[model samples]
Target: MRKHKIAVVPGDGVGPEVIAAGLEVLQAVAAADGGFAVESESFDWGSDRYRRLGRMMPEDGVETLRGFDAIYFGAVGDPEIPDHITLWELRLAICQGLDQYANVRPTRLLPGMQGPLRPELGEQIDWVIVRENSEGEYAGVGGRVHAGLPLETGIDVAVFTREGVARICRFACELARSRPRKRLTVVTKSNAQRHGMVFWDAVCREVLADFPDLDVDFKLVDAMAARMVTHPGDIDTVVATNLHADVLSDLASALTGSLGNGATANINPNAGVPSMFEPIHGSAFDITGKGIANPVGAFWTGAMMLEHLGEDAAAERLMKAVERVTENGPRTPDMGGQAGSADVTKAVLAAL
Candidate 1:
């Protein structure tokens, strides 16, 4: 049996609660199968810890995380802390330092999960949004030229490299091949930013030549958004630059269900380094301790982590159990049900 060590960072607010649910699911699946052993260690590195320790995580945090098989992360944000300080110190630090460059978010609606989308647009939405994690718009290369001055100026440069663009495009293509639909769409604004967008388009064209069997297409970000609203079924796999991907994935998540139920996986496939998994939603400080937060997103994220770690059996079982739970319709308030976080989590465990 393989024994995998998992580092659990039960971040701020409902992070702790949902992580508890995910851990419960892990233990339940392990107990039933007896095929693997998972040893987990908890870390206190979130907004609350930040408030007391004056740092999001320890100085040697990446070193500690490197020792584990994978890091099961919860959301990180606080009303009291500045957004930059909170995000940079915690989530972004792990992503950049660990080089988890493939932000793979599968946007699929759970059976009972409902959102504010038009009723008719509900049933026909399922797709994966693959974002180039490392470079491009999120590179953080540029900064403010002046602060607290009459004429304050700030600039953020989008950095795109051949390696970065090619890798994510390939990842998206591979994902599309696995799905029922074998179509891959590359999103960019080559009409505007000639250099950067053209470079992205060139890489997409180069990558597509390698995957000759797959159907390929490209669309501008603005027109793609309109198409997503009208004909989401036309899209099978979407690969885009960081900033464009950021907006489109959120839209994709909304189309499936509430933002609270969206899941994300940040991966570095070359090294043996494990991926980081979390929900798309931020810390809900307003409803933190009220027990009203949804745990579906974090639980499904655990399913994705299990799949990535080569625990295919466990991952499939957990996902089926979640689908069963969702199909039964014991949803939380965010999805239009009155159940609390623990209630929905317990229901999922029961189904498992």
Candidate 2:
């Protein structure tokens, strides 16, 4: 049997709760598949640990992750900790440290779920948002000088490089080529921010020239937002800067069903470092320990992890089981069903 090593990081709040449910589903799927085995090691590294030790993770955290075949990450944020501190120190740290530059988020309305959109329009929302993960607005390239003064200016530079943009564009194009649509929408803001975003736009066009078979279009960020709701079916594969895609994917999640059902994969396609799989839903502190946090996103993320590990049959099987549960099994509060996270986990396990 093929054996894979997995590093599990159940970060904070309901992260542990949903991750527990996801782990259960993962084990059951692995058992049912019989072609492979997953051995996991848990790393209790997050706000709770930060309270004990001043850092969210150890200094060598990224190095430790390098040894695993893949990483299954839970959410990483605490209301007690400043959002910037939590995000920069934990989640963004791992992503930038490991150079996991392709952040892929897939959104689709499940069979039995009700989206905020018109029911028929909801059915047409099947799109994948690929963010340029390692750079752009989240690049951490600015500074704040002058403390406790009226002139305390905090500047965050939106940094983009030709190489960075090209690689991500190429990555998105390759993904578009794989899908039946073979179409890509490059999100840009070249009208306002001339230097960096225009550079981004130019680099992407240069890269697209190599991918002659792709059907491509460039849409400004604002219009793209309206298009997502007004015409959700028009978008199939989208690539944008880190900031734009981050916001759009949230909107994407909302239009489909709930953030509780969103799944993300942070990948380093060219490197040997482990890629991270996570639910795009942040740590829901209000639902922490309530046993009602939706596990479908986590379960779906587990399926993504399996696919990254080359377990195609297991990944497809896991997603099928998820579809079965979401269609007719017990539901979670986020999904408008009264069932708790555990119940949903069991329903998926049973489907498996």
Candidate 2 per-residue lDDT, tens place, 62-142, comes to 999999988999999898999898888889999999999999999999879889989878999989899999989989999
Minimum summed lDDT over a 10-residue window in model 2 is located at 267-276
Per-candidate RMSD vs. true structure?
Answer: 1.4, 0.8
Q: Using lDDT, give the best candidate's number.
A: 2
TM-score of each predicted structure versus truth: 0.96, 0.99
Off by over 4 Å in 1: 118-120
Among all windows of ten consecutive residues in candidate 1, which has the lowest summed lDDT? Answer: 114-123
Best by TM-score: 2
Clashing pairs in 2: none
Give the per-residue lDDT of model 1 (tens digit) for 1-352. Answer: 8887899998987888888888988888887779887789999998888879999999999888998989899889888899889888988899999898889888876786665567566666787889988889889898886699988988988999998899989888898888887888899999999999999999889989988888889999999999888886787788888889889989888887677788999988866686799988878877888888888888889888888888999988988888887778677777777888888888888888
